[model samples]
Target: MDLRALTLLAGANSSGKSSVMQPLLLLKQTLHEDRYDPGPLKLDGPNVVFTDAGQFISQVAVGQRPRFEVSLGVGKDRGRLLYEPSAAGVTLSETGVSVGQAPEIIMRDGSVVSARETAVLLELPGLEAEGKNSIASRHGIAHEIPLVPWVSIAVVDGVLLKGSVEFPAVGWKTHLSNDLMRLIHLGGHRGNPSRRYPRSVSSSDLRPGVFHEQAAGVIAHWKQHDPASLDALQSAMRTVGLGWSIEPVDLDATAIDLRIGRTRETSRAARDLVSIADVGFGVSQSLPVLVALIDAKPGQLVYIEQPEIHLHPRAQVGVADLIVEASRRGARVVIETHSEIILTRIQYHVAKGTLPPKDVLVHWFACDPKTGDTTVTAVEPDAAGAFGDWPVDFAEVGERVDREYIEAAWKRQSGEAG
Candidate 1:
């Protein structure tokens, strides 16, 4: 699925919204193990862990091989990798590379190659001969030329042969690889509120869902090294209507204490700081999310699941503003949420021109009862803040409850009159 600047995945439980994100997380984990020799896409690793192939694959057709494909790109250049489960690990089957339109290269042998072919030949090792022959057969060209550096292509007789080709350097791939290294994912079930958060010098990226485990440490690190980040974090917290501020207290060299500050009103003096445990559960749950967003660097992607958890309706709406602001700053954001308030706020932002409509994309997922498989449908918002083909059942419980209340009131009045 193609992702925009800000993408939302919304659906009921068991509707496969998370399925779309699993493969990418798996790839990130695998690449992290060894970027150069990452043998197979890992099902289990530092980012995510799946039990086995059966659990990883969505649907297994009878007598059909199970596999998944992951494609990534930066700007116009694109690359894809096909993967299948093997006894040892996930195996990469095929690779495809596409470089945007570039001038055709002419070899001394009179053979020509397109920019796309040149990219593929350079990326895949030992494919130069096959690539050259295919190009020659398609073009019906013949020439006798030896492989040489800076030569685009060579041919001998009717068959094309491998030649030293200087491929255009594309920096997007390296940038994409670096992005994969620093990817941050926060899962739906996050760490529960604790009295204190432990400190770690090595924990740089936020862990899946367990971000709360390192929340205080992250804040402390930024506070000491980059205090401006704490300002950004506090600004985000205030935007979410959480008046409290966060500060880290050194318990020891190995541990840090997280303290919550109470905002003072115009008429009141400054209030004393309190332990994070003393605040509401929602504050604790949202702290890590805000911290992660504020700390994200430009071009880095942050994936958040159910960020509205434990938040009030207004706070949920506010979180949408945070997501939009983050996207506007060049940080890619992918969110999976069931909160209508968040969706409504996003729609409002698009309608009001706070965010461009093209930059926002929404995917609704549904489950097939008979097959027990999940299906995804794309829903686009118009300039008027209305979603075309809005699902009738989505977030309809409030309306249903209102109808039930009206029915009960009518029944009571009739019985009293009778």
Candidate 2:
């Protein structure tokens, strides 16, 4: 799938929306654990776990090979990893790497044959000597050779690579790798509401699906080091009509308490603090999402599943606005949601020109009744935020219910009058 600056996945349960995210999460976990070599892809990890190959693969046909492919990057500077199920593990079948604005270097199966072919196709001079030396050095065929500064060769075993390559003056390899490494995902089932949170050292990287457990610690760390971030989070909460500020109360060095202070005008004192559990459930449910978005740094990709959960319709729209603000601040945001309010808010933002239409993408997933396969259709919005051909049965259940109630009420009134 082609991901834009902001992508929204909307569909029914088991319609394959989460299926798109599972493989990427698996890859992220594998890369994070540094276990991407000499094995089939690791199915069980800290972030996610699968029992076996049967559970991981879909649409199984007897005697047919099971495989998955992931393609990333943009334009000529792109990479693709192909995998096949193996008894020992998931094995990497092949890899395709392209760099430079014009496809200068190509590596397939950890060999430089594609590079030589690319050189021949482009008719680049001095490639025969430079390409051979680079490939020899990468494969350990040569200990030392005069290397070309513009061209570099690298090898991959499975999905792991040992070295870095530079694309002339571009340095696309490092840039692309860094982008991939910055991916962050928050699962649908987030941390539950608790009275006290543990005080632990904050890591530079946020853990997937554990934002709730880390919220208090991250808040305390930022409160001490980066007060502006805390202020931003408070501002977002206010925007969502929460009208409360969050503070971390140290129970001791080992644990901290999260206290919510009233921010709205009231007869009581403004400094009065209450435990998060004492407040509405939506407050605790949305705290992590607000903190994550406001804390996002530039060029980071943030994935949030069901941000609208436990929120009122108005609050859901407010969360949508927060997502847009996060995107505007230079972070890429992807969300999966079932709330029509959130979708309507997004359309409003696009139509009012608060956000560019091209940067927003909406995908509607549906399952084929006969084949039991999932199909995705792109729902495009124009400059006016109007979508042509809305997806079938998208948020129509409420209207149907209302219609049924009105019909029954009319029949009862007619029978009584007769």
Candidate 3:
């Protein structure tokens, strides 16, 4: 199944829309087996901490472990590829493998193990020795995991962006590239209008970092004669009013770096000319995400949080446009947004027949402040981003008005209408 990039997840405040990001960003952490060696960042662990809007929404709940399940369609692979970690290393399974049998285990020993007796050795008790393979484990279970349409997700701040990557899982470490970082730091999301350095320097003196690396990737694609790729990259930057250009340079006298050029009129150029902190909060917040999307290769996945943050209504629409464009180019893009404008933009494209309606979904999460209980409501959008029907209190403007109106009506009925 080729995942569409133009997917949108929208809901009101504290609606758990952001909570959806938790599972996606914590994919490897949550789905892979216990022995998976979740890496130094250890994003997969129970204690992984995440902050959104200055609030702590850690994965490890005190006195309780938050549990959830994820499902996806199994494409050509017939849902064979699955990852579940146990006390041992990560385990891999195919459709033919029984859950009770010892899984093809990737062990801490750095060797792959696959023997019936070894299943018990790995501490995977659920494997019943001769039963159909099940997705369930100590953690949540996946109904299906597929290949072909690459899937990856990330959580930032509080937003979840789930999409397929152009590169393999191992490829992301390189695809992000170094040049992009330079672009981001030089006021990418800082939202400044003009460049202001904590230290003074000429534009030529600026070096490529995360922002620069991303921009370079974009420029490289543009140079490749791939129009769809170029269009997606340029459209994203243009939506935010930034410029783009690249040059080659020597790095540590060992290799040439793709030196990205900036012109504020163009998105890339603006970062060089302005300080991120000085720009509109929207600019500071959104541009880096835009660049990241543009630079993502066709088969790789990207996760972003709140691309709508600080963005004006118009720019919010622009962000949606960029996301959709990337998806059309074979990159799966998932986003968690609170902005109605962003949601509206998504619906607009769908309604206009420019994008697919089924590709995107809106989930509304309602969390009870008192109980800490969360309910997820899946919303399907028409082409116009309008809901098939707005649930009662979805926005609740009517309730607010009704309360005041009823109060006045009661007073009038009681002859108190002075």
Number of backbone-clashing residue pairs for each candidate, in the order shown: 0, 2, 73
**Which tens-of-lDDT digit does each residue in 1-418 have in candidate 3?**
2334554555557666545544333443332223543321234243134422123233555776332333333222111223333233323222121122333322212112334423332354332332223212222222222211111221110111222212123222222221121211212133343232122112331223223223433444345545665566555655655434333233343223343335535554634543343444554455557656665555445555577766666667777777777777766666766666666677788888877777776666667788767776666666565677654253466567889999989988889645
Worst 10 residues of 3 by lDDT: 153-162
Best by lDDT: 2
Please provide, for model 2 over 231-253, each residue's C-alpha lDDT reduced to its tens digit, 9 standing for 90 to 100: 98888887786656777888887
- Pairs in steric clash, model 2: 40-89, 40-90
Report the number of backbone clashes for model 1.
Answer: 0
List, residue by residue over 324-380, the lDDT tens digit for candidate 1.
888888788889998888888988899899888888888888898899977788876
lDDT, residue 115, candidate 2:
36
Q: Report the C-alpha displacement of residue 87, candidate 2, in angstroms.
A: 2.4
So what's the TM-score on candidate 2?
0.82
lDDT of each: 0.67, 0.69, 0.44
Least lDDT summed over 10 consecutive residues: which range in candidate 2? 140-149
**1 or 3, which is superior by TM-score?**
1
The alpha-carbon deviation from the true structure for residue 267 of candidate 2, after best TM-score superposition, in angstroms, is 7.8
Clashing pairs in 1: none
